[model samples]
Target: MEPMGLRERKKLATRRTLQHEALRLAIEHGSENVTVDDIAAAANVSTRTFFNYFSSKEEAIIGDGPPRPTADATAVFVANGPTGDLLDDLKHFILSPMLDLSAEELGYTFTDFLARKQLMLRESHLVTRMMATFAATEREVVAGVAARLGEEPEAIRPQIVAALGMTALRFALRHLHHHGDTAEGAGAEGARAAEIAELRDLLDEAFDALRQTFDTAR
Candidate 1:
């Protein structure tokens, strides 16, 4: 992959600083209490600049997620280099991107994401907006996968397959938050890595199930 332009790199750095500051402040004070101005000040950026990156305070705290970490895997699948086994391709695409996150960038505890999820859930308005973004992203990913599989993008089978994949991923993330590196009682990086590994295993199993049900049925 090509290196990021200097300006793009700087922008990413600024965005990360804002996100990190926002998360830290939210963790320290309640999410409700932290204002956009406060986060901007913490990140050394103007409040308007914060708006340029995120739509709202909630988004700043836990929005604009990590870029798809496994694009290479997705590219391989998209190219149909493996005879178009969508399930296998997806498994590789999904898991491989995570490996790209630097250790420090990957340092987030599953527990923290869980806490943020819970907190965001309580904010129904923000939750609603965030869900819209998620849904749109889901469809885009599904369409991309469907295209690679030579399936009609709008076909029920492709949509259903995408839904199943998404559900399994969600379950895996929840499991990580509840029992793995993100267990409520733990806060260490070691625990976090273990949780991530467990989540990956679960995803792999889920993909296996998907393949068995779909590929075998066909």
Candidate 2:
């Protein structure tokens, strides 16, 4: 990867500051009570600058930047041919973006959120906010799955698979946040690794259950 230029580094720093500040302010006050202007003020950036990075306060609060699959993941999806197990491929495609995250990056995002009791207390509200952000990503995943299967994006099968994949991901994330890393023996890195492993296990269980349900119904 190319090194980040000074300008890009500055932009990233500013965006991180805005995101951290936005979450802090939203947690201190209710999300409904916080405005973009308030977040910009807290971050010491102009409201215009905040808008340049994020369209709304919720985006800053979620703090994952944008919902986008990495280039390699996208390439893998596009290059995939008929594997006969569309559902399994769909699951892999859906999770590919997360697979690209480095261990440190995963810990920074998922583990940090899991550690925050305040965030957990507002689970419903946070989930609602995250859903809005996830909508576009869902569409993208659907398109990718459809393309891989030589079907239209609007096809019912692809749509259902995409939705189920996303639901599974959300369920796994929530479960991890609540039940992961409770052991006192594990260090922080160990805990994070365990959490990730548990997440994969949860996803596998969910998909297996789904497959079983379909088979039983048939």
Candidate 3:
């Protein structure tokens, strides 16, 4: 809701820089050949600074990612909420953390994110780290949904909502990957806006499909 302060933006910028360089170096020289020192030097930051943002080069390549909901957003969703509609609210709760922030604001574009994903596919070594990151993200979603429902995290309702939310996100992203708006000039504002719109529409379709499926079952 509130605009990010200069400090937070600066930190995000640094993190983005480190991640971009790490990905770039790994892609070029191969992840096996690249070290923390190489990524840090490429980013023009010291190894110590790199370590502050990421535990290792592999971690940096993954980025501070999957971009979980902020505490503020999660609290609002748990309490007041943007909307009382369960599916709609859960969609917003899961995606607003990303949709609310522009790619430029975060110092990383959607295209950059896709590039990181491609790197993960190329580097088998990063697979384990990526899996752990995804697992942590799922838990966070389950916890947020559970808190809102006043249910334990292991409860079926929270688990189902969390699973639906993640599936919708992945579906939207996969759709985006096939769409061409992001293939070139993704740095342009119009391209970025189109990408956002595409992702939002696909997510809505995915959730709406879920609603339809369940409504028919009922």
Quantify all predictions' global Cα lDDT against the true fold. 0.68, 0.71, 0.79
Compose the digit string of candidate 2's lDDT tens values, residues 57-126.
8778877622366556666766772344766766666666656565545555564455333664774567
Among these predictions, the greatest lDDT belongs to: 3
lDDT, candidate 1, 180-211, per-residue tens? 43445554455545555776888987877776
Top TM-score model = 3
TM per candidate comes to 0.76, 0.76, 0.86
Q: In order, how many clashes per candidate? A: 3, 0, 0
Query: By TM-score, how accurate is candidate 1?
Result: 0.76
- 83: Cα error in model 3, Å: 3.2
Off by over 4 Å in 3: 1-4, 106-109, 177-187
For candidate 2, which ten residues in a row score worst on lDDT? 111-120
lDDT of 3 at 192: 54
Q: Which stretches of candidate 2 lie over 4 Å from their true place?
A: 1-13, 35-38, 62-67, 81-84, 111-129, 178-189
- Compared to the true structure, candidate 2 yields what TM-score? 0.76
lDDT of 3: 0.79
Score residue 173 of candidate 2 by CA lDDT: 68
